[model samples]
Target: MAYEVLVQSVVDYAIYLLDREGRVSSWNPGAERIKGYSPGEILGKHFSRFYTEEDRHADVPEAALGPSLGGDIQFETAVP
Candidate 1:
């Protein structure tokens, strides 16, 4: 499908979707490359994995999702 094409072809941006509970629902090739997680390994996992340990300890994941409940959040970061 065309949706699949655009999402999967991205290479510089980590493109993916999260469920209501912040679990990865869909993953793209760029997400795999940038975050080091293949869909098989990361799907259904919490987005907390992308946070630093200190951030996790600070409950940053939950806080980060609060403002974006009904919208999109965009920021640029280098992931590896």
Candidate 2:
């Protein structure tokens, strides 16, 4: 099986790659569909853009990055 091709073509799951400092380094088509952002628009941006204002104020983005950076973490959330 061609795993890379299968993952890249997924439309039902958003895939993101964040840098050490938590900026978006990669974006996928499914992420575009779910988050309303194109790869060009979101890449190089902070992943915090996906969170609510109150969450940002609470440092939720930084907190969330810890687990993902330490190891693979799968999560799902709906963004308005």
Candidate 3:
């Protein structure tokens, strides 16, 4: 699909999709490069895996699923 190609071709930003329950469902090449996890390693895992320990302890990942004023959800994380 054209969309698949576009997603895979991007290398400057990490782009991915999550399921309704916040599980990683689709991962792109950019995501693999930026996040350092192959699809095999991260698919089906919670998106919270990218968050810092303090963020996880604070439930920041779940909170990010909430509606946002700008109509876009974004957050930063410290990746290993």
Best by lDDT: 3
Candidate 1 lDDT, tens digit per residue, 1-80?
99989998998999999988999999998889988999999999999999877767877787778766865554434334
Error of 3 at 77 (Å): 6.7
Predicted structure 2: lDDT: 0.82
With candidate 2 superimposed using the best TM-score fit, by how many Å does residue 37's alpha carbon deviate from the native?
0.3
Ranking by TM-score: 1, 3, 2
TM-score winner between candidates 2 and 3:
3
TM-score of each: 0.81, 0.77, 0.81
Q: How many residue pairs clash in each candidate?
A: 0, 0, 0
Displacement of residue 17 (Cα, Å) in model 1 is 0.5
Which residue segments of model 1 deviate by more than 4 Å?
70-80
Per-residue C-alpha lDDT of model 2 across residues 1-80, encoded as one tens digit per residue: 58667767988889878999999987777989988899889999999989988778877778778786785444454455
- Per-residue alpha-carbon lDDT of candidate 3 for residues 1-80, written as tens digits (9 for 90 to 100): 99999998898889999987889999988889988999999999999888888999987788788653234456666655
In order, candidate lDDTs are: 0.84, 0.82, 0.85
